[model samples]
Target: MTEHATRHTPPEGPPGDGDVLLVTDLSRRFGDLIAVDGVSFRVGRGETYGLLGPNGAGKTTTISMVAGLIEADAGTVTVKGHRMGPARVEPKRHIGLVPQELAIYPELTARENLTFFGRLQGMSGTTLASRVEDVLDVIGLSDRAKDPTKEFSGGMKRRLNIGIGLLHEPELLILDEPTVGVDPQSRNSILESVESLSTAGMAVLYTTHYMEEAERLCDRIGIIDSGLLQAEGTRDELIRLTGDVDHIRLDGSGDTVAAEAALLALPAVEQVDRERHTLHLAVHDAPTAIAEIVTEATSAGMRLNDVQITRPNLESVFLRLTGKALRD
Candidate 1:
């Protein structure tokens, strides 16, 4: 199929409106290793913002500091214009965190877990009970609230983990790989729940290595690597970082190896990958570059069976920035 034409627009300057959460020059260290180095970004109210990076990219360390689980060696984190720290207890009320690890007790029922957390947050009696039930319904676990968490499926356990965070209805919900290890059905359910929360005006700081999840869920995403904010914008904005390149998929025969190398030598070619009979290429300009590729293949006695060129996607953008696939 013919690739759709897309215009790449540059990222605009920071938003003029007040940000709900802001971090400036955030840094963390583990001895000589700089786990989080000078990361900075802002999340707007009612915005679904994503922090995307591979493992050990400092995503967790940054969020941990923002959530007050760890103190930053330098930098400041502000929530609703109030700075974060031990003394900022009021700001703590404005933030909720769903960590990568399940924080609930396996021995406790889902309701018990939620209630326990609610009480620790200063809730009690009927107020705590009602809130637990409310979040149970929000997480689609109202019917299973009485079941011990250990007996639940992986997806159910994940939902309950999220429920524990939402019990207090904090203004900003930070989710760290909430869908990891869950079944596809469960992952979809959790994603839908997150979307619903954003629709209800809850600002979310979502951290994940899953490109598709970020593309589907985030209003904007911040790409971090090696302790720095490499890029920040919507998926389209990030894709623009890869210049004007568009992607083309080709299936052909007759020494695919030579064809792959030859395509990479073409002017305006940015990236090329050959897997079996399928070849994926990113080029500076699709129309001209694809034509040249087809001509070269034909000259080399290759039979081209299928060709598909697509506009640059988040995956392409990610590959360009990180020099590695998202899964890698």
Candidate 2:
């Protein structure tokens, strides 16, 4: 690729002000299947850009190209102003990738593992040692720094995996589904670490199938499905793309038909559907409509089990656009 097609020089100053990563019209295909179809997005320094999609939604394929592991059939990927390719060491040097799969050595102590990876990136002597210590503290494994990784809990190992990526102090950190199978506590810990990294001025590209994760961490999100980028924006912007109102789910043991009819009659309610004992309502204003809905249900002789008012969010927006949940 030509230098003009790949590199972009920022205006100058602190990171996150100008775009740190720019991907334009990137496309990749495997025989008959187009895994990533003309995908494009940007990540500013210190900002987290989430690629949200379900399994088999091309999120992995997209990131593989960005990471320079796979070449794109079309378009360009520029990292901090340098084009990404197998031979482009400078651009790759600016990226720190923590893949979905664990990349640490189970038999090595945490310190040893960090030192080895740091040395691979050309770090040495006091600098590598200090960087390893810093990474150990950052990943919350300072106390367990001497323990063999095999003895660590799943969460600790995952954290160590992340630390390995940070050893080189790359400008961009790409975390691909960092919390896949860990317990809730570990998941929260991982999210907190990511937040801290972004706060410290590291640009992050986070990919996940979890709606809550995306909502919690991403400054902006790009929703991809079936190899296509369906939508891209902030949480509120994506919700607006759905063109639907708020949602309320009522769980009760009552006359179901009457409850649906009553809620549908309310001006604030736009649509109503039933699934088992739950009444799903699409409404203009959930806060305003919920009280009336509860009143209607109680009047219908239904014993209240639960009442939930859900605002338009990433999940709802995904459902509206793709007719499937983020998990599906």
Candidate 3:
């Protein structure tokens, strides 16, 4: 079981400024193996909360339970004060889920797909038509509204997937790795769409293995590993939990093995790794240690090609706590 610092009781009414999604002691099991073990966190109104972990870290299982697609073995999921279970229609109404897969129909036009989902959500007539138009504008596909989705680009299809989620304008939006296989241009478009959605006051629960996305889009993040929530907080708070360390990378030719050993012997250096021509070092005080590192490289007969000092961020924090890369 995972331990939480504090526990919150389910509120009586709509989650007043406190939280939109409150998950407490959530755990799930598959026969003999526990998938999600005691995860807990809260996402406030209009806030973006990121759930980050490596593959098989239980992120998908946890999200499946939250979406009411699977029943939890133990614990509670409260969405805007309503408890979520197999037959909870009200809570489900408040959530719009955009899964990792393409949920839009390839044969239908963008507008048609929106209308189809909008009507399924109980929309109709003028309201449904207006919503479809509005969603097309929001997704930047108004020009392509009448074009068949099969003709759309990968990014456009992804945007349409998100449009399906917004057809009902649910109070909370859950996006699961929406940018997986798209090109850089398409990825940026999808990210911009997410930012706009949050600005429109929709609480978002996002799951991604990409550290940059989590850092850019999340107001707070929960890091889960091995079925446990290792830490949960804002980026700064999570980084602080990993202690103050700066990551430095040096790319050079010649004697990388000797350079790696010399850097590791430094008093400020915590770890050293060498990959062919590149050397990665984690140090206590980077600003003061840069000169020492260069000196050590010179003394070790390394022909330096490039040097970079990167400040610690979510990736570093994740590496510190999980002891594995996020992509792993």
Candidate 4:
């Protein structure tokens, strides 16, 4: 939401100074089909970089390579200046990955789950104890830490899954759809926790199907389709590429032909369509031009009944680029 980056892959050199994650010309294959084709992006310190795509879009595959959970058939993944791979242990310490599926035990309490994962990452004694409590607070689950995960709400358990990933406080955190099936209130809490993490200076690589989440949480976003990184930039920057214009519609009575003639002469109006008593207009800067458009139509002898405007957002851009809705 604050900082931004468009460096999909930096120039060949030591991984772009402060870049926490650098993926360049990354590719992968599953038998004959290409699952990931030349995808690249970077996540800088304190930056929340969102990767958005529908199912079977190579999002999860890319995350797996970045986390070194799997090997890349081609290209490279560097984390905190070290090369990353499944066999590479050192660089793995700087990365924390929270998968889409719930990675917790229903029999264990929140605190127990944190302590267990913390110990797996080599923490013990007071350090693990302190971190478990801290994470419980960060996830807004402090009061419910002792309840079995099965007793927790869907959102609560999801938060605990995120807390497990946060236990080590790695420099780069990769979250894959952390709010998939949770209730709205719980989803908001998870979002708030992520915001706080970004503010505290942790780099995050996020992937989601929600446009609002990307617009709200990410400093920059990368849209992937058919195993390719289609575009990357800040929300406003990407929207500008859509070349999408706002619309103004007018429903009225009286001289429709005269109003159509007058509306065409307006500088802001791009095109107009008329069907019976209503005129549908394609216009730029609708907010600033609506008043002028309404006056012109009324002056042309059309008595106005109602007016409406539709503006473009991230979803519009997504639809334009991918030829499908984000959820589709």
Cα lDDT tens digits for candidate 2, 125-237: 99999999998998889999999999998989898988998899888999999999889998998999899989999999999999999999999999888877788888877
Clash numbers, per candidate: 0, 1, 0, 0
What shift in Å separates residue 148 of candidate 1 from its native position after superposition? 1.9
**Candidate 3 TM-score to native:** 0.77
Candidate 2 least-lDDT 10 residues: 1-10
> Candidate 3 vs candidate 4: which has greater TM-score?
4
At residue 180, candidate 3 shows an lDDT of: 89
Q: How well is each residue in 1-328 modelled by candidate 4, as lDDT tens digits?
A: 0012222343356666679999988899999988898888888999999998888889999999999989999999999989999999888889888999999999999888899889988889998899889989888899998899989878888988999999999899999999999899989988988898999999999999899999999999998777888788898778766678888889989998899999999999999999999999999889999999999999999999999999887898878887789888
Off by over 4 Å in 4: 1-14, 253-268, 287-304
**Tell me, what's the RMSD of every candidate?**
7.5, 6.7, 6.1, 4.5
Best by lDDT: 4
lDDT on C-alpha atoms for all candidate structures: 0.83, 0.85, 0.86, 0.88
Q: Model 3, poorest ten-residue lDDT window?
A: 1-10
Q: Candidate 1: give the clashing pairs.
A: none
lDDT of 3 at 100: 87
lDDT of 3 by residue, 1-328 (tens): 1232222222344445658898888999999889998888888877999999888888888888888889999988988889988788889888998998998899999998999888778889999999888889988899999899999988899989998998899888999888889899989988888888888888999999899999999998998887788888888778767685788999989898998999899998999988889999998768899999999987998999898998788887777776778888
Q: Report the lDDT of model 4 for residue 229.
A: 80
Error in Å for residue 62 of model 2:
1.2
